[model samples]
Target: MQLIAHRGLVRSAPENTLAAFADALSCGFHGLETDVRLSADGEAVLFHDRTVATGVPVAAVTRAELSHLAGYIVPTLAEALDAFPEAFWNIEVKAPAAVAAVQTELKPRIERQRLLLTSLRHDIMLSMAEALEADTGFIVWHRPAALNSLLYAAMPHAHLRTLVWYYESIDLTLLQQANALGFRNYVFGAQTDHEHRLCEEFALHGLITDHPEFVGLTVTPPLQ
Candidate 1:
């Protein structure tokens, strides 16, 4: 199983910042998962919330304005790709407006195989899959919805390539079902040591966690 850094090793640095991403990679995380939103100018920026710390809507302000308000400039999607050219990316489009911009920025620079585009909005995920060859995954925050997604992905004709579930929503039954169906399962918010162990025991395809080191250390067992 791969250990993915959620928001780029957020436990080590500010979430979605370059510093966090660098820390994750340096510590040997297999991939990076981040949230993307469009600035006022339509640039794709790394951010998790619709608003900044001061409650300014990111879409309503230019990246520069948002940066000023936050005291540090947020990394752009392009910047992240440039800085970490070898890293696998799981880019989550946080809003419909960001879909096109994220695709445009990534299409030319990265290969489809190295990326996984996901979102809570099914329409946006489908649109991105149509626009790019990269794999598409769904982010399910609720248990019932997650079960539905799992069942759907089991269909031979289903286009879903991955299932990203909220960590708390997953259980042994769901894991077994996903494994039985051959769907690549990933979980987010894996913050505890026990959760990391569960990921290994289940052989999940990946885990999204703020503390990558905790999981990264166990990605490969010590050589005998």
Candidate 2:
């Protein structure tokens, strides 16, 4: 199973910053996951929320304005790709507007195998899957979507290449069912030691976590 650093080892550095992503790679994480949104300038920026702390919508501000405002350095998607050329990226398009910008930025720089594009919006994920050749995944955060995901997984032409669920929403049965259907299963928001152990016991494909070091250590036992 892959241990993906959520927001680039958020505990070590500011979430979604180049620094945070670099730190995760330096610590031997298998990959990094980040949220992407479009700035007012239509630039792909690394940010998690629809709005910043000031309650200003991210799309309403330019990249420079966002960089100066605060606690974290919001790196552009271009900057992140350049900074970490070899690391596998799980880029989440937080808004529909970001899909195009992200596609334009990533097209020539990396191959599809090195990236996984995901979104909570099924339509956006479908759009991205059509727009780019990258591996696409759907994030199921609610019960309705989870049920739908299962049904979708059973379909022969289901575009869902992967299915990620809220860690709390998944159970052994779901994991088995997804695996049986040849769907790669991943979980989000799995931060605790116990959760990491659960991921190992179930043999999940990967998990997103803020504390990669703690989870990695728990999942990687001594050779002896």
Candidate 3:
């Protein structure tokens, strides 16, 4: 089971910031996962949520102005890449344009084995898969009802080899069914030791977690 650093081991530092991501890398995390959204100027920035929650709107600010916000500064995908050179990244593009922008900025730096682009939107994911020529793209499907439809649509294609469905709880039955239907990667449950065992049992390629160090410690028992 591969342990992914969710938002850069959010427990230790600010979520999705360069400081937090650097900590995850120093802590020996296998991979780093972060969300990407488009800025006001159409730059691919590393951030989650559809909009800024409490303070000034990110979309209203320039990249330089966004860097001066309270807790976390909106970092461009390129900034993130420059910050962490050796770490592998799993970037979740929030929408269509964000995906395109990320592809534009990060394409040259993305060596085959180091990056995995994922999204919740089916068409966006399919389009990204096609554009990036990736062998397998991770799609985040939340509701159970959407799974059948998504799989149905993706069946005709060869590039999409993985499906990452999020849920409040794990239904092994559903997981089995999904795999039976040809879904390659099934990411479920919380970040826990028990979940690690479950991931191992299912032969999953990766496991998402809020804390990357926990996964590194629990799954592989770090090298001395």
In order of appearance, the predictions have TM-scores of 0.87, 0.89, 0.81
Off by over 4 Å in 1: 110-113, 145-159, 216-224
Clashing pairs in 1: none
lDDT of 3 by residue, 98-178 (tens): 776877876676563477677777787777666776544555545555457657767766767677656354456666776
Tens-place lDDT per residue, model 1, 193-215, is 88788778877888888765566
Output the better candidate (1/3) by TM-score. 1
Ranking by TM-score: 2, 1, 3
Which regions in candidate 2 have their CA more than 4 angstroms from the true location? 110-113, 144-159, 218-224
Residue-wise C-alpha lDDT for candidate 2, range 1-224, written one tens digit per residue: 88788888666578999978877877788899999999999889999988888899899999989877756568998888888888888989899888888889877865533888888887887766666666778887754545444556325435456888898788787778777877788888776778778888888898888775557432233245
In terms of lDDT, the poorest run of 10 residues in model 3 is 213-222
Q: How many residue pairs clash (N, CA or C atoms closer than 3 angstroms) in each of the candidate models, in the order given?
A: 0, 0, 0
Q: Which stretches of candidate 3 lie over 4 Å from their true place?
A: 135-138, 141-148, 167-169, 177-182, 186-193, 212-224
Each model's C-alpha lDDT?
0.79, 0.79, 0.69
